[model samples]
Target: MNRMAALRQYQKVNSQAQTAVATPHRLVQMLMEAGLDRIAQAKGAIGRKDVAAKGVLIGKTIEIVGGLREGLDMEKQADALARVDNLYVYMMKRLAEANIKTDPRILDEVSGLLTTVKEGWDAIGDQQPA
Candidate 1:
């Protein structure tokens, strides 16, 4: 093959790799992995009904959600992003309440909420621009 043809093929391969790397599915997968780690830490606290540890986990989750929200473009998917943001805020509130009450039930509630959020995110098309 000529030099020009080889260059074109290389470019094509590089572009495809970039596209595969930048999909929304990958973003969701990253978030789910981080969330599972946080949830595992929180689970121990929940079992003991330890308010302080619960608060720490809640703070970490909030940080995760905040980071996600900052990267999200609400204009592109206004309704969906808004709903996700609202859920994140609600989760923060519930976490606070759980900490104050030392309640394990709230941990279960947050787990369910996070699961739903993850599922919803996964269902969306992975059309993020490369």
Candidate 2:
């Protein structure tokens, strides 16, 4: 192969290896960011005692969780992802209840749950995928 062709091939292989090395860390970061965003929105809505706003945030939270699940391979991370999914669903329900009753407690509960999930994700520390 010519020099240019060999350099291009080398770059391609390097790019693939980089992606392989980064995938798990990227996934964890994405999940953590989503969870943190949801928690922040929920907290803001609760602070304002806005039922409609809380409902909207809850809907977004559900979407984020669903997206996380879609990006993940269930066979590889089924247990952890399942648990996170369940917590997300539960948070949605709590948000709905808070909206109906304008209860700030529900928001606090969901925020705590999201915090726990974020901590768990941090603990994984870029390790190999489960």
Candidate 3:
């Protein structure tokens, strides 16, 4: 097989393995990491003038963050959820702005915000609901 195809196969298998073994908390952490990874890659793509990759990576990052926001339970703690939801929306807007203006600084801003959120989530223990 070609190098690209082999790499894709490897990634697919690796993802499947991770999914099979990951707990809910682990999955959340994984998702957070993936989002950060995509944004970092998008920043690199921007630097390299690879417009298509930049767009794809930024879009994927937005989707991941949006999924995280959508999974929030509004009834669990309305005030806190609303705050976090707003932050997610803000992050999405920043992501779009980064894409539109081709600004790596905007990507950095969103990455930092995501890292902060991920750190808080990481601090949560077994009490977090699945």
Candidate whose TM-score is highest: 3
Tell me how far candidate 3 lies from the true structure as C-alpha RMSD in angstroms. 7.9
Q: Rank the candidates by TM-score, best first.
A: 3, 1, 2
Which of the two candidates, 2 or 3, achieves a greater TM-score against the reference? 3
Candidate 1 global TM-score: 0.65
Which is the better candidate, 1 or 3, if ranked by lDDT?
Answer: 3
Candidate 2 lDDT over residue span 2-78, tens digit each: 22332232233222233234444454455446545755776688788776777776666655544444445546667
Query: How does candidate 3 score on lDDT?
Result: 0.78
Model 2, residue 125: distance off in Å is: 2.2
TM agreement with the true structure for every prediction:
0.65, 0.58, 0.82
Better of 1 and 2 by lDDT: 1
List runs of model 3 lying over 4 Å from the truth.
1-17, 126-130
lDDT of prediction 2: 0.57
How accurate locally is residue 106 in candidate 2, as Cα lDDT from 0 to 100?
Answer: 70
| Residue pairs clashing, model 3 | none
- For residue 71, give model 1's deviation from the true position in Å: 2.4
**CA lDDT scores, all candidates in order:** 0.61, 0.57, 0.78
Model 2 clash number: 0
| Candidate 1 local lDDT, 95-126, one digit each (tens) | 67766776667867887888877776666644
